[model samples]
Target: MTLSVRRARTNDVPSIHQLLDYYAARGQLLPRSPDELTEHISSFTVINEADNLTGCAALEVFTEDLGEVRSLAVRDAATGGGYGRALVEEIEHNARTIGLRRLMALTYVPDFFARLGYGVVAMNTLPEKVFGVCVTCPKFRCCDEIAVLKHLD
Candidate 1:
């Protein structure tokens, strides 16, 4: 199946929420409410095939030089089809277009990020990330998610 990655529209919010909810429920990522999705809707990209949402990802800017890839998820039926990679590439493209120097993710799939040119880094090194969101996580003191970053420059 051919997939196209595009900037998400307001109408796509429900699909994005559902995709994130699927993975979040399985402990792969954090669950985001529709309100939160609306707040950051502009940061998102969705992969669609013939009008069907196949996957989605978002890039949340933390600073002029840094951004975080969040809420990345691919439908179970869409795995191994490069939808995830395409979504990340789309996010990277946006990051570069906006002049960001780095892109990061807190993920369980370190190998996937590594394949996309990201390197694993210590969570402690990312103060902006830790203080901004990690602090509010229930797993803050014992987080197992790995920090990975890719230089965009």
Candidate 2:
């Protein structure tokens, strides 16, 4: 099964949300609103098979040297087919092209990112993501997600 990614558009928002929600509901990811998705549409890329959006990921720039890979989700039926890794690679490539020195992610599946060359890091190491997103997370006081970083330099 060959899958390809493309920049997300306005019409892709619903499908993207649905994909993310699948994982979010299971506590694997944070939930995002359609409005938020729409607002950050340009930050997203979707993997499509035929006419369906099966996976989605976003790169959120926090500083000149740091960016966070967030909101990554693949349809349940599509997991383990490498859609997650592909989506992450797409974001990682974009990060390098845009000159970011490091990419960070807070994820439940640290092993998955590790296989892609990310190393676990202390959450304190990413103050930008901690203060920007984690502070607002309902699980802020007890975030179980592992922090991982991949240096592009």
Candidate 3:
């Protein structure tokens, strides 16, 4: 089961949306529309195995020193095989390449992120995230997502 991560192309948007929708329905992540995925396609990377998309993640810059890892999802059939970790690493590599000093994620799987060197943090510490994305989230006031951050510097 060899998998490779590469920058997402327009053709991958449908698969990306499907993957996110799966996790989103389970409340593990947020749902993204195909249009939204296409708009930010360049910020995303997808894991592929023999022409099949197995997983996807995105690095979205919010500030000079901050970025968010969004829409991370692995296919149901591909879970527990290191695809998620690989996608996260690929996003981190992109964050470092773009000179971002920190990367954050609002996730239900905090322990998974913690194992990857991210520390749990207070949501208030990320005002940009709170005011920008959180405010628009349906779960805003009752948000159950945990904030985790990894410093690249």
TM-score each candidate: 0.96, 0.96, 0.96
Number of clashes recorded per candidate: 0, 0, 0
lDDT of 1: 0.92
- Cα deviation at 101, candidate 3, in Å, is 0.3
Report the C-alpha lDDT of model 2 over 32-145, residue by residue, as the tens digit.
999999999999989999889999999999999999999999888878998989999999999999989999999888999989999999999999889987888899998888
Which whole-number lDDT from 0 to 100 does residue 77 have in model 1? 89
User: Lowest-lDDT window of 10 residues in candidate 1?
Assistant: 1-10
The TM-score that candidate 2 achieves is: 0.96
lDDT of 1 by residue, 1-153 (tens): 566889999999999898889888899999999999998899999999989999999999988899999999999988998888999999999999999999999999999999999999998888989999788989999899999999998
Pairs clashing within candidate 2 = none
Candidate 1 residue spans exceeding 4 A from truth: none
Question: What are the RMSD figures for all models against the true structure?
Answer: 1.1, 1.1, 1.0
